[model samples]
Target: MSPQPVLLPRRHWLAGSGAALAAAALARTGPAAAAGETPAPGAAGATKPLPAYAAWKDPSSLIVHSSNTIETRRSAFGTGVITPFGQLYVRNNLPAPDASILAERDAWQISIEGVKNPRQLTLGELKRMGIETTAMVLQCSGNGRSYFPDKPGGTPWQVGAAGCVLWSGVPVRWVVDALGGVDPGMAYLTGTGGEKLPDGIDPKSVIVERSVPASAMADAMLAWEMNGVPIPLAHGGPLRLVVPGYTGVNSVKYVKRLAFTARESDARIMTHGYRLSPPGGKGDPSQPSVQEMSVKSWINGPGTDGTRLKAADVQIHGVAFGGMHAVAKVEVSLDAGKTWQLARLAGPDLGRFAWRQFVFAARLPAGQFTLASRATDAVGNVQPEQRMENAGGYNNTSWADHAVKVSVA
Candidate 1:
């Protein structure tokens, strides 16, 4: 079942040598692993597969943590997580190659040089050169990182790292207008991932490389399906690089080369990890981090540990997003964060960049309780309980504050 790729609208070519000093020599060599060592065969180790749910809860007792439960429901705007499918959240940076040698290797190319005819193409020539889908929403520039207050260097991720899927691929401005447009002094576009820098880490580390610009690579994209299947190898199978609104570490995974520069590409995961710092301001380890993704929201399940209302009128779903916009509203606070109300949004099936599920209803006020939620987008923004300091903890977004503890006689 391998043969899909046909979508056009190309233009791209930018040549090299700018490298920004090899992106500071790959961020002073830093991703070779070895501190506790274990990630190698398809990496992201520690034991890998998770999300069965039976135990492991704590992240303020599930306001949303325990690695962000995959799915759950309670209603009246009170218990939600619902990510579903394989439980989402994979977030790899590197470590997912060898998918049966990429489905029996049809030679698997995809070269595309600066463009105008650099060519390499394969995966059935990008599915006869005409595939496109795009739903967007990747997240994970560290997702939440244990809520990072001070303990943040890399991947402590909590809000289940993030996900939205849909992808499909080929756009990226039709491979930069078929390789012949983006040159106007092009300013960065790098991207490489086929998995290789493991062994004790630091093959000149630098997160293994990923750069942006070229107007964010003409809105970037190369994905090869996901949610519509074909994108599994730990979540980067065959190809990946969706950058829409950024984050997810510049949306790169097993991508294996993209080039087109004028500067920025020495990789160390693109000049040292998913950066951010503007809104409330604070991050600037010498600038260069704002990779996108900000407005966020959460409220996974019967959290604050206090569920018992077998019935009596309850409904409080949750899930709001804002990496690319279009959430617009979703408030619900029971008290903990001090007054808020307005839930019920849910209508926009996957495009405003995905993620928008809200509900609200209450009629129990009998025993114990604690509930919360907050989200606001459509440009209004909102959603920020903390995050804004940045140095390493990368983009966060903040606004967590979820809580559950219900009991209503």
Candidate 2:
């Protein structure tokens, strides 16, 4: 666990303030913000403006469930090539980072340890080593927990806790490689977000630290920039780990440490949480850990379940992704799963980890209808009709398995 002292870079840390925000706000005072408008670009660091979702090309009408737990409704899933940064789902386990901290991105530091020669590096230094960008989906392990058959007692997320983001940062392996290469014997490469918990919570129980398999280091990045901007503090700013194809928790926002070790952190998150327990059972360590997501798809538009509309040629569109590969094909079903129609894939293939957007259209007479979709990945993985039940609701991709009914007047 020996880590060298942090070597701060030449960049000066910026300070944020309210007056600066007010000045910036005045310029963008459109009809939208009646007064005291949210700050636009060039606002001081202190101005933590709410991101523009409904305000900027927002279609799904995303919901805010606390600053940290917002949900992206099903209609928004296929709205665009990239989920708007402001409208992206939020699932912060801890309090969201404040503006001051995010403004200090230049000073962000991560301590690397446990290897033969450990060292500490600032965000500036990490960028010098190597910078790569990959667009991928960051999904909460329990995104659809609310629909679990057994019923879990945690956040009732309904497939809204996931989004595709373009993340850019130094390869995590660069850190491991810098630390004199990894020792093969080590099983897990542990890391942690630097956020502190409240006084009453037991420090040991807090999952400030969690980990990914060492093999995953090859695809992981210690990202400081997301979606072409400095990573917002709300997401995981200053720095965060972006492990493509893994659950969002594995991304570990506000990251500050990296340790390659044989033992998993005793933190509740690593052991008790994120487990795939048996149906109706509490988390069981013996069961497999929640890692890659399963094949899944969601019909995003033409309104949500039970949506009523006049008879017309309704366009049905959605998004789908594979656990470990690009989505090869996506199919939609109107009369439940009795018949399926291949939907057209659209836009660019950001990467295997990024979901593929699909669209289908049909002219409907006045009547009641149901819609459903299934996806097949490049690796031959097919979306299942029924989700595998687990008490924790870790990977509820099966939420898309059922038919959603809509009314056509």
Candidate 3:
């Protein structure tokens, strides 16, 4: 993660460059893939609102997909170091805990069991272990989920179902180490959250339990704060497990129970949801679940589609990130990939899991043009020109992904 600047109050950061604010997210929609009753307490009318986001985002500009999820646009690389708490994207499998309960996180208990030394820790106890900060990108497993050719299944996410945040928490390793080390036989760290389904829905089926590989526990965090402030209910306040580099699903929210086990959790979420299909094949239940994200990048601006092409020189910038490696560099294509130019990467390396910001500049004579971008990670993975189509549109990293057009005056 990048070095954190001096901490400031929420209003200060909100009014400033938005670097110090804490956050809260989603995509657009069709027939509404998400089911179950509305989760937000005091939800206005038929639509559930994320109050934390309502504090910052212009409601008029948001794309409400389901009762809960919302999406943000790209137009950044020109703004804050961390996505403001109010502007961070949100996605929830279950309804959030009421504000009254979240306001008293210290009263909530996290049941940590199944390890050699099973125990319980309140939110206050976890916070007393000292503070560390990490700035990493947190993205929904289906951040790029847009129904192109397939029938829309879930939230219609664009690029906005993702955000970079500065999290404050205690390393999960510390907690595990305090418990006398992990058993070599343990293979998974399964977690369950507080969001439960409305009455009548089989509790077992709708539970948002997920189990991540135990290996992630090494760098994982039990975070309670965002951008240095107490996290809001909308952003998984009280506590959330954050696993960097992996998709957002690994970072479970409203964590109430966690268990170390010898195998993956059998919870429907882990057993049936978010699995990746064989290349070019529809999602097969027998296939393994997805973990690291594929390398990807896209142009953020120049026309309304991307910014309007101007007669004068235009500056272009966007974000690039995927999986474990930091972005090495981004390449820009103007003539439909017939040619390419390297764009300058900005700033020093943040964290390996943090997204790399990039920029390019040029003057184009009046005409209509197509602009596209691709990124290569330090690990040698290059954003492909075409991504294999997935039934769920989980990782939509295709060559034409985010390609934009503008007519120059």
Candidate 4:
């Protein structure tokens, strides 16, 4: 069993102070810090203030990593399927465009290329083309970085940097069909963000452009609204690309360019970043790009604040999700995986990409116990016992690393 963490008052954890303390501890022990690797210039730390657009988030429900980076607290997820806007995490690759841009939201234009008749489409014009909505899990590429033993160079996120959300937009397929279809040789779909570029730097070096498999366009969309409202600027307003079953970065925020390419984008972000590298290795074009997420699940209720529970009936509940498939079932292990019991899957099945809530009830006597959850997807892919080691600590779906340790009195 994993060693117990130091216990703290519930109030501290709930107020977000203890969450900061936990993040600081993880940062100090990361492999980069241990090997004396210097932090990149201007790299944000755990103490930066939240950005103006994120001021509405509940401080008690998030761990602020930087002005543009914040994560939801696992406990704050509660039992809801649709994460409340105030509790959803915020992650921005570049500073969001000024809120003043919302003044002419309908007039925002997106250039479409690689089609028989390439043209620009205004947000208002696209809205008149077709409308569709989908619910999917929007997760960061390094969501489980803290669980990596080698420790990566990004935010030490755990299970909170992800959430299921509803996006409404014009389907990419419909747009392409109306525009006379994509070029015959196109093999990739690329989206470019609209954030203003910093001066004196090669725009390609820092632009947010990602090229995904052309097949993704089947479920891809140019989303103008999130959770039923005009997409908030903080989360990418005016327009954003929504790719279901893929990592959040692929859903370009403030998207301004949509194109079908014969090859992937040449942007540095596409050619050099978000790649899966060997342990202690540097990312490069040879490495695989972060795309679709994998099957994962973890306990959320009975928070891991080291609190003691009563020696009676206890209800254990959490969430499970399949990256591209539906979760078949969730199993609960109260004795650190020694014995398992099938848990009741609660709530409505939102779809294959949406998470399913799982609940289990158990009676216990005074003792120390560890709780864990295992999930299997429709294709027979089971959540693993351990995570694969990698330079960026990207995909982590291990049951052991995410298990909750608690005491029953």
Candidate number achieving the greatest lDDT relative to the actual structure: 4
Off by over 4 Å in 1: 1-113, 116-135, 138-150, 153-170, 180-264, 268-297, 300-317, 320-345, 351-353, 366-409
**112-166, model 3: which lDDT tens digit per residue?**
8766687899989987765566667888877666624563467767677887777
Give one clash count per candidate, in the order shown: 51, 2, 12, 0
Residue 227's lDDT within candidate 4 is: 61
Q: Which ten residues in a row have the lowest lDDT in candidate 1?
A: 10-19
Q: What lDDT tens digits, residue by residue, belong to model 4 across residues 1-409? A: 2112122233443365433432332232111111212222233554455678888666666667887778776666767666767778888889988898789999999999999999999999999997766667899988878878766788788787898776778889999999999999999999999999999999999999999999999878899977667888988998999888899999999999999999999999999889988988988999999998888999976735445678988789899988878888999999999999999999766678778889999886788888999999888899999997889888888999888777888
Candidate 4: residue 171 Cα off by (Å): 1.1
Pick the winner on lDDT between candidates 1 and 4.
4
Taken over the whole model, the C-alpha lDDT of each candidate is 0.56, 0.69, 0.68, 0.80
Better of 1 and 2 by lDDT: 2
TM-score to true structure, per model: 0.31, 0.83, 0.84, 0.88
Task: Give the Å error, residue 259, model 3.
Answer: 1.7
- Kindly report which residue stretches of model 3 are placed more than 4 angstroms away from their true locations once superposed: 1-56, 278-285, 304-307
Candidates sorted on TM-score, descending: 4, 3, 2, 1
